[model samples]
Target: MLPPFRPGTHLVFFALLLTLPSQALAVIDRDALDTAVVDAGELSRTHTLLVAVEGETVIDRGWRGHATDETANIKSLSKTLISALVGLAIERDIIEGVDQPVVELLGDRVPSDIDPQVNDITVGHLLSMQSGLQRTSGSNYAGWVASPNWVEDALTRPMVGEPGERMRYSTGNSHLLSAALTEASGRSTLALMRDWLGEPLGITIPAWTRDPQGIYFGGNEMGLTPQALLRIAELYRQQGKHDGEQLLTAEWIERSWAPRTRSVFNQDLYGYGWFRTELDDTTVHYGWGYGGQLLFVVPERNMTIVMTSDPTPPSNGSAYLEQVKAVVERMIAATVP
Candidate 1:
C-alpha cells in the first residue's frame, strides 16, 4: 500500500539534499552526474532519469527494466500538461475565457443542495489553484469516486475563501479544467492532447486513469516517458511552437509564467499552470510532483531535468528540489562560452 501524505495528498518527495559548494561546482560531465545521483541513497533506485541540454539528450539512464520509449506514469506532472491544454483551448476560442464563471459552464452539475458561491468561481481561479474548493485528492479520492459524479461533486464544494483570495493546492481544480475543456471543445482532453501535442510532437501517451464521470484524474497518475516530458518542456520553452508551427499562443506562455502565488519556500513562484523560479539568476520553470516526479525546464541555460520517484516525506524532500537545482547550477558553472 502507498504511504501516508500531508495536505493535498502530496504523493510525497525525497531527494538527497546536497550542500552547495563554497565555490561553484564544475560543468556537465553527463556520465559523472548520472553516477552521482544514482549513488545517492534510494534515489539511486529511481526508475528513470533523463537530462537534455539545448534540445539534445545528454544523459539517459533506467533501472533494471526500462527503456527510451517506455512511458512511465508521470503522476502529477500531468497537471502542467493539462494547464497547457487549457491555454490552447482558449487560443482556439473553445471557451470564452478562463474568467468565465464555472457553474454556468457546467450547467446542472453544481449540486442544487450546495452553497451558491460555487457559481462565483472562474476558470482562471481553478487553473491557478485558487478555487476555494476542498482538495479532492488523497484518501478523500475514494469517497469522491464512490459518489455518482466526481467532477460535479467537486464543483459543489462551497467557496473556502473569496475566489483568488488564497492559495490552496488542490488537484480537483485541474480535473475541473479537464471537464471544462471537454465541455468547451466537445472532445475528450485525451483526444485533444493526442491531436495537439502527441501527434505534432511525435510523442506517446501512456496509461491514464479516468473517473466514472469520464474526467481524467488530475494528479495521481498519468504515464509519460522522460523524453516526452522533456518535449513538453521544450515546447513551452519555444513558446508552444513545434516543428516551425505555433501550437500555443506566445502570449499565453508569457502570461502563464506570471507569478500569481508566492511559495512558502524561497526560489519559487506559481503562475497559471506553471511554477517559476531562479537558480543563481537563471530562470527555471518546472512542475513538481509527489516522490520527486518533475520536469525542470531552464530556458536561459537551455537545459531540462526529469525525475520520477516513490513518495518520500517532507523532511527528506526538503532539500530535494534544491539538490536538483544544484545539478543545474553545477552544469551552468560548467558552461563558459
Candidate 2:
C-alpha cells in the first residue's frame, strides 16, 4: 500500500526539474543567428537578408545601409511570381489546367511561318522551362528584348528540342506565359497580380518594365522588397494559404513543387519556377535571380529566407552563387537543436 505523504516535497522536486535546461525546451540560438548575419554583411553584393522560422521573422538585416523594405529588381525571381500567377489563374478558371496548349491562348501572336511544333507547347512546358524554344535569357537577351514584338519573337524562335523534352531556362518562356495569362483573363498581368496576390498578400506590387506590346516583363526586372519577398515565400511555405484564406490551391502548390525537369546549369531540379537542391543535407527549394537575388524555402525546417543582392552585371558567375548558398546553409545550421 502507498502512503499518502506531504505533497510539498514532490511538488518542490518537480519545480526544480522544470528549471533545469533540457533539449526539449531548446529554442533557436539568437547569438548563432547574429553571427550568421554578420557573415552575410561581409558579402559586398548582398543587400538584405531576412529569415523566418515557423512563420515568425527572427532576423531582418540590411547590409551596406540598404533597407529591407526597399524595392529592388528581383531579376529571374520574377519567374516564381509568374508561376504563382499562373497557378492563381488556373484556380480562377481564367486559364485551364497546365495541360492546356499555350497556343490556344496566344494563337493570335504566333507567326504565320512558324514551325508546326510550336502548337505542341503547353502551359506546363513554359512553367517548367521545357518549352523547347530557343533561350532568350543569356546572349540572346539583348536582341530578344530589342525586337518590336517580344511575344512574337519568343514564339517564332526555332525549336531546339521537342516540347516538354527537357528544361531550357528561358525568360521568353516565362514572357509567353504572361501573354497567355493576359489573353485568357482579359486583364493585364499586372492587374491580375495586384488583385489576386498583391491585395491578398498585402504587399506592394510596383509597376515593372513593359514590352513594346505593353505587357509587363514576366521573368525579369520585377521589383519587390525583401520583406515582400519573404511574405511570398511564406505563402508557398504555407502551401498557398494566407490569412485564413486559400489564396492558392494546395493542389496547385503541390504541382508547382513537383519536379518537372532538371536545370543543366546547376543540375538542380526545376519545378514550376522554383529550383530544388540539397543544402547541408537538407532539401531546399529556391528562386534564383540574376546577380544573387534569392528566395529559399526549407520545408523541413519550416523556414523561409530571402536575400537580395546588387543587380549589376558581371554576376561573378556560379562561384558567387555558391557563396550566397553557403550563407544560407550557415543560417540553417544555426537553427539546429
User: Model 2, 1-337: lDDT tens per residue?
Assistant: 2234454432111111221264122245566677778988898798999998767788898887788999989999999999999998888888888999998988577778777999899999999999989999889999999999999999989999999898999999999999999888888999999999999999999999999989989899999999999999999988888876889987987888889999888788999998998887898899999989999998877789999999998888567888888878888876652
CA error at residue 306 for candidate 1, angstroms: 1.7
Compose the digit string of candidate 1's lDDT tens values, residues 220-323: 57888777887888887677777778888889888788888865543478888778877657777888776567787776655677766554444244366566
283, model 2: CA deviation in Å?
1.3
Supply the global lDDT for candidate 2. 0.86
Among the numbered candidates, top lDDT falls to 2
Which candidate number has the best TM-score?
2
Q: Each candidate: what lDDT?
A: 0.70, 0.86
TM-score of each: 0.82, 0.91
Regions of candidate 1 where Cα sits further than 4 Å from its true position: 1-45, 263-267, 311-319
